[model samples]
Target: MTEPAWKSPTDARAEFRGGLRVPTAGWCAGWTQANLIAVPRALAYDMLLYAQRNPRPCPVLDVSDPGVVSTRLFGGDLRTDLPAYRIFERGELVGEVADARAVWRDDLVAFLIGCSFTFEAALAEAGVTLRHQEMGVNVPMYRTSLRTLPAGRLGGPLVVSMRPVPASLVATAVKVTARYPAVHGAPVHVGDPRTIGVTDLDAPDFGDPVEVRPGELPVFWACGVTPQAAVMESKPDFAIGHAPGHMGITDARDSEYLVP
Candidate 1:
């Protein structure tokens, strides 16, 4: 995928002054991508607690202070740096915009959560084919009966993203991703949807489902969707997320966060 053209220094500075600009996910090739959420400072600790309680789904990458736009951990300016942002008001997605300037607030604290994009580079390195990238569609995801530990006002079922791996490569995929426990780690379950409460694999709750060939297995992962599910169920007054495929690129390399 071609990276989006970088704006001129003057244009970038102007954007930072006026508002934030969303970068295309393709722009940050090889860098770890992240899912972002901004919440009021009063609820920050509670949300962090929830993330801690459910590490598989809500693996945290970094957390920013109230009114602070710069994320020191990822070397990013929260205001206009990501590729896109989804704004939710009273649990409803009000808009999908490139940046979060109009609704930026001083009392908001930003949270950066680990995303499966962190491991995509590794998968590619191992020669595992990614169906979504090949077909130019978003990954398939679903809400499962698996429930996350409740913290403060946050509590809900777990959401997962799916990838169809060849039967021969399933073990390799698991072995490779198992090294990154802090960013979702290993597969929660494999080959069976009913075990996870999925009635039909063809119709996913989110994203497009890819075909499982004669020799392929439908492997599921604990997705970054856990946070979004919490948002939907708890109905946070307001929230923000990165647009699908467009993630917040960071200075952190994929290997650094691995458990070894």
Candidate 2:
């Protein structure tokens, strides 16, 4: 039998380069899918400090040495691994590209932030069906009125990813995810999106929103993309990030991110 294209990290990159531009959820399940951010060496320290201050949404996984394209934690080029890349020039999203090879820079620093997809995999194992995955769409993400602790020029509204969990299993979802603090631990907010300034669940700031079925509580998690949100506010001269829901698949197992 031919193995699925996304089953291997290498193959996943190939699939992405082959023009597969959609959410990476449920693809390469059990492996880690990271949020990628590449910034000039000048802002690297501020970004690092930002991640440290806002660890819930910006947990550090692997940070590449300046000019390095290969990852120490995974076997893939930083420039070409992710499914999609978002380029931000002067705080505004200028373009979405398939790979960032052309814009690769010697002074660029790439950070691989922990993603909730690992926890989502755990949730799936615990029988919490990810509605977005089932519906074949990106998990909904929202830009909240909540603010992240600022680090230099790197600070902005907190970004969150939403998943509608069965009301009965909301507790189970929380418990299962709480074990992986490095990968966004657990639900930060549940129930009312208005509490977080999410006016409508149907229309998300980023990614496609899934239906909130009757009796399903919309569970929210601090997202890896929070840095991107912060970057939008800070508006560096140049920056690169993974498109929401499109992530850099890594060889590390999801269990590697679990806490005792």
Candidate 3:
């Protein structure tokens, strides 16, 4: 694995805060990465309930009070620390920006959701190759046919990220990831992408698609991007989220979310 440019979560956030935008998959080594989603306070309860009902794809790490820019989990500014942000209005994506300070609202409540990238270090240690990281691209993500249980006005199809795992290491990948339940643990589906309504692996709804080698099986994990999907489908009046592959690196350690 290539060495990351920055070593600590704080350093990584500094790079992002300075307007550097890139997928965060291998950025902060053992530190945990989080998905950012901020919505109006009026919709906060519904967002919380939605995560409660769909814990697999929407695992909650830390939630900021309305208009709060930082949380215990994240020490940096929420509006400017992440690599990229997506702005939504009435569920339609309107802008992708390097900084969200201009669009941030005082009434907004931000949720820091667990990301699968937190476990990539564990997967690599276990000898499971992460194709996207190996190829220097964002992990491929797809919207599935499976619908999440609704909460108030929030409901949408489940979104999943795919990693091509060698046929022999598939079980190892599952075992290693299953230990990190807080980060969407285990493979929700393992073999055929079509089983989950994904017809073409080459064309992904978000992030760059990776090559599935001859001896590999495309493994899928529930993605934190699911909330963005919800925002797009449910059409909340206003929403802000991390760009598909870009994420918020948190101060929390990956070991904190590891299961016994």
Candidate 4:
């Protein structure tokens, strides 16, 4: 399948800022994608501690100073660059918007968390089929029975994105992804969805569900969405996050996170 027209991270950010809303999975192929979570300065420490404690699902790439939008990894305006943003009030999702400037606050500190999508290019190059990309839908993500380690006021069940990998290519997918440890490398669980308390693959906690072919197994990976889940369950007064599958495209290349 041909990739999206926006090959550069700057182009993708500009398009998103211009109100082009779409899941970012295949947008900037070799560029790294990140999960955005902005919270009050008072809560930033707790959030950072939570991520450090639960590195699998919350590997942090960069964090902004209070109210800052641009970071070394991302140069676009955080409030308007991502395709979609979710605004939360006391842990309730109050709104999802194309631009977050209206709800953004001066005391908010943003975090750019590592996303599993960063390693997808490597997987595709290795011949592992990406069903969600082919189907033109966001990856399916679930809130699993596994719980994350708590830090201060942040904690919740782990969130995972599921992909159906052909049984034959599962090993290859694992090997290719494992090289990018900063991007939630490798599958956390494979096979039975029920094993992880995901009773229905079609009904996910976040994003769209795709078909798990007969010869394919449902593989799960630690998702950056876990922080958003924590914001919900932990009752943070205010928070902003990228709408499930809609991520922030970073200027950094995928190779920057790959290990030799």
**What is the lDDT ranking, best to worst?**
3, 4, 2, 1
lDDT scores in order: 0.76, 0.89, 0.94, 0.93
- Candidate 1 C-alpha lDDT tens digits along 169-216: 999999888988877888897898888998888898877777777888
* lDDT accuracy of residue 260 in candidate 3: 84
Give candidate 2 regions above 4 Å deviation: 1-6
Listing every candidate in turn, what is its Cα RMSD in Å to the true structure after a full C-alpha superposition? Answer: 3.7, 1.4, 1.5, 1.5
Q: Tens digit of lDDT per residue, candidate 2, span 135-182? A: 988899999989999999888999999999999999999999999988
lDDT, candidate 3, 1-260, per-residue tens: 32563568887888889988999898878899999989999999999999999999999999999867999999999999999999999999999999999999999999999999999999999998888998999999999999999999999999999999999999999999999999999989999999999999999999998999999999999999999999999999999999988999999999999998
lDDT tens digits by residue: candidate 4, 88-150: 999999999999999999999999999998998788889988889999999999999999999
Q: Model 1, residue 165: what's the lDDT? A: 89
Clashing pairs in 1: 20-80, 21-80, 23-82, 23-83
lDDT of 2: 0.89
Supply every candidate's count of residue pairs whose N, Cα or C atoms clash at under 3 angstroms.
Answer: 4, 0, 0, 0
After TM-score superposition, the amount by which residue 54's alpha carbon in candidate 2 deviates from its true location, in angstroms, is 0.5
Model 3 segments beyond 4 Å from truth? 1-6
